[model samples]
Target: MIYLTTFLFMLLAYLFGGLNGAILLCRLKGWPDPRTRGSKNPGTTNILRFHHAQAASAVLIFDLLKGTLPVYLAYFFDYSPVEIGFIGIATCLGHIYPPYFQFKGGKAVATGLGTLLPLGMDMTGLLILTWLFTVAVSGYASLAAIVTALAAPFFVEQIKPEYTTPVIMLSILIVLRHISNIHRLLTGKEKKIVNWKQ
Candidate 1:
């Protein structure tokens, strides 16, 4: 029974994760598919590039909720921390490669943050601060995301050791997803937040 319930939750979480808000709003407003515009990603950053801040904000909130709501349910149901980690990563993966979206989804930055904040507020706060600080100084959103994603496991290890192992596994996946950004940074062509203005 326990296994069955967990499996169902995982499935629901993945399908829900695939429902990208940016894609929906783009079509609603008659905007071109985000996948064919801007950075060509079905996430908030690309929406901001193709649309306006309001549209991007909506996408951000929606994506964040996709990660938050499902993982929170795992906690509310008293699942172990390890199980919660699995649920969180499931959502992230859904965002990265949602089927209905032709397997081209967002990079999962906002989704991953949404997934962890509720589970470990203090550690998540640190991660958020690190991201903001890095972006402010470096102006590279991808760099900030990479740094924080890499650091998440250590914070979990110290504060919630039981979650550490799975968190590390999830962190690896997130970092791996950022490989393109890493290469762009090395080539001095990575997009910065400031670039959004012009």
Candidate 2:
């Protein structure tokens, strides 16, 4: 029944992750859907374009929470590292392609951050720092994501070897998802974050 249990847990994790707080908030506020706005992405960055920074921050935190809680639940259940990683990946996938959003959802950055929380604080911290550094230096979310994803395999392998395969697979998927963004970035046409204070 272990396989069955794992599948059930993954399904539940996906359901939780699919709760797109940004889209919900936009609908409640009668604001334009973020997917139809700047960048055409249903994520915090796009939300910031349509609403206050506070609103976008709220959505980001909520999305991160959705990604985090599931993996924690799997850990609580005393699952194997592979199982936990599977659940974590499932959560990211759900956030990236939420059923509630008709399978069009946010990029998996925040969700990936959430999934890494249970792996270990040090590893999670490293990933966060790397992502922040990339974003700060490049101001391109896609670049940050790609750089962070490329760093994931090394981080997981060095710190959590048991999860290496899963982490590597996740990194591949995240990198693939950002391929279009990479192309735009190369062409100097990638969407840049606007200074909202003005």
Candidate 3:
């Protein structure tokens, strides 16, 4: 019964995570569909490019919340580490492949942060710091994402071994989703988030 309950919770979490918060925000603000502009992604980065920073920040926060809420609920229910891990990973996956977006969605960076933050603040801090440092130094979102994704599992294992597998799996998905960005970065064509104006 516990396993059944966990499965149901994970399913609900996925459904919740699958909401394209940026797209919804865009629609509400009467902005163009985010997926049709700025690298054709419904992520906070793209939203920032086409919309106001405040709107983009709101989307980012909500996207993170979507991933955080499920794992938090699992924890609140006193679910085991493994169950919490499952919920966290499912939430990230749902953000990447949101049903509301026809299984098309963002790169899941912010959502990944959400999922990781509840599991281990140290791990989350390391990932965020790494991403920020990389982005600040190189001005490449893809590079920062790739490096942080590679580093996140290591941090998780070191700080929270019980969640090693789930964190590793989430890292792999993040890296995979960023593959195109990696290619573009390599080819010198990836967009950089310089000034917010464009």
Candidate 4:
């Protein structure tokens, strides 16, 4: 019965994560599909880049919640760290390759961070700080995401060893989703967060 419940929660997380907020919100607002503009990615950065901040904020909140809500509920119900980690993994995977959107989805940085909230606020905060610090110093959002994703397992190992394996899994998935960005960075083709007058 417990296994069944966990499976159901994972499925729920996946379905929730699959709902691409940028796409749905843009469609509802009669704006161009985010997938058809900017980076051609249905994510907050893409929306904010080519569209309005309000829409981008909405997408950010939605993405965070879709991953957070399910995991938080599981945590509240006393689910094991491993179980919670699996749920988080499912949530991230759904965002990365949502079947509802033809299996193409966002990079899932926000979703991945959101999943960590149920583990510990310190863990999540540290990762967020890592991301922000990287972006501020380097101005490359993709680099920040990559750094944060890579740092997740380290943080988990220190704060919650039981979640190490699951966190590592999530980190790998997040990094894999950023492979294109990684390539661009290596080739000096990746775009920074905003234009600078350097």
Q: Please, what are the lDDT tens digits per residue for candidate 4 over residues 1-198?
A: 999999999988888889888888988989887878867889989988887788889999999888889889988999998899999989888888898988888988889888988777899789989988998889998999899999989998999899999989989998988898999999999999855556
Model 3: CA > 4 A from native:
195-198
A best-first ranking of the candidates according to their lDDT comes to: 4, 3, 2, 1
Over all chains combined, what TM-score does candidate 1 have?
Answer: 0.92
- How does each model score on TM-score? 0.92, 0.93, 0.94, 0.94
Better of 3 and 4 by lDDT: 4
lDDT of each: 0.83, 0.85, 0.85, 0.88
Mind giving the per-residue lDDT tens digits that candidate 2 earns over 1-198? 999999999998888888888888889889888888788877777787777989989988988888889888888989998899899889888888899889998778778877888888889899989988887777777788899999988998899899888888788878888888988988989976632344
Please provide, for model 3 over 2-101, each residue's C-alpha lDDT reduced to its tens digit, 9 standing for 90 to 100: 9899999989988898897898998887889988897998988888887788988999899888888898888898998888988888888888888887
Candidate 2, pairs of clashing residues:
none
| Superposition TM-score, candidate 2 onto the true structure | 0.93
Whole-structure CA lDDT of model 3? 0.85
Ten-residue segment with the worst summed lDDT in candidate 2? Answer: 189-198
- Per-residue lDDT of 141 in model 2: 72
Clashes of each: 0, 0, 0, 0
